[model samples]
Target: LSDPFVIIELLPRHIFSSCVEQQTVVHKRTLNPVFDECFEYSVTLEQCRAEGAMILFTVMDHDVLTFNDFAGEAYLSLNQIPGVDRGTSNADNFHGLKEIELNLMHQRDREHPILKTLESRLGDKAAQDFMKKCRERVTNF
Candidate 1:
């Protein structure tokens, strides 16, 4: 049994400084956890239209005595979201809610181009630190 939680990150394609992050409450002692939650980001429609803007969902197993373990991750592009591509649309104007189901990948793609680019940012302390934390979360068990 594992205590699982989810971290949601909104990231711009080329700018890491503007990243917005949120997390779900940990669901204790269950491999199958239901995180019925909603997160709203203070992002503009322009930001949503920006190329490569995406939301990353990372699931982690909570641990009291040691580092949390990575369970899985999913990525969704802002462009693909409903009401995002529509003109002059507000949440209230969007009558129905669109539910998105994503398949989680159990393993991290170490050789991904984005990961490589982030890894190459040796001069950027923030990027380096972010990558370091991500690397540390690689499943060892």
Candidate 2:
């Protein structure tokens, strides 16, 4: 039995300053949890077209006494999302219903260049602390 939840992040390529994050409510003791949630980010269409811009979904198991455990993760490119490149003139089209099923993966690039760059920033205590928390969330000990 596990308490599962999901963290969703909107990351723009090379623009770490504008990352947006959101999360879903934890569903108790269920392996299959349906998260009917929506998140909105204030970003321009150009930002969505930026190379490597993506949406990252990380699922974790909640623990009352200890830190949450990483379950899996999925990544979706911004360009792949519906209505991003098509313009948002029609609010209806922009907000049109589109469903996606992502195949979660257990392993992630721990030594990713971005992660290394973020870790190397010793001056920003907040970034350092955020990175530490991210690492802890993904680490299962």
Candidate 3:
């Protein structure tokens, strides 16, 4: 197994853009990694609803000489968060920890430019195979 890390981005969709972007520390050489990590983003509920924000989770393999490998990707919406409700779009409704499950596979419905770039860098076949392993290996977190 390779050392792995997670890159998380909270990007606002459409007119609204750029907000929270962060990454977790790399776990060294483990098939099963437990990351009891926490991250806070200062995004208002109003902004989230108006922009239709998406949380992008990119799992990558850490490498020294060569470029890191793209393991898998999962996407989440701010609206899907426990406290946030789309119907109300109330700022007061935002609070607390929500357990979000990432898809861990290529989402054909929407285009992911980052994934395409990573695949191009790693070669299409290599990226596809690695991502497949990531999907099989990682079910939930």
- Best candidate according to lDDT: 1
- Candidate 2 lDDT over 1-141, as tens digits, reads 889999988764355456657899999989888998878887777788788778889899989998789888889987777666565534446455567779998647877787788888999776787588577767631
Better of 1 and 2 by TM-score: 1
Please, what are the lDDT tens digits per residue for candidate 1 over residues 45-110? Answer: 778878777888999999999888898888998877766866655555545867789998865567
Best by TM-score: 1
lDDT (CA) for every model shown? 0.80, 0.77, 0.66
In angstroms, give how far residue 80 of model 1 lies from its true place.
1.6
Q: How many residue pairs clash in each candidate?
A: 0, 0, 0
Clash pairs, model 1 backbone = none
**Please, what are the lDDT tens digits per residue for candidate 3 over residues 1-141?**
989999887754332345546899999989778777888777666766655567878888888997677787887876776546656444454365455656687444223575555546655665665456544534431
Instruction: Itemize residue pairs with steric clashes in candidate 3.
Output: none
Candidate ranking (lDDT, best to worst): 1, 2, 3
TM-score of 1: 0.76
RMSD of 1: 3.5
In candidate 2, how many Å is residue 98 off? 3.8
- What RMSD does model 3 have? 8.8
Instruction: Supply candidate 2's per-residue lDDT for 6.
Output: 93
Q: What is the lDDT of candidate 2?
A: 0.77
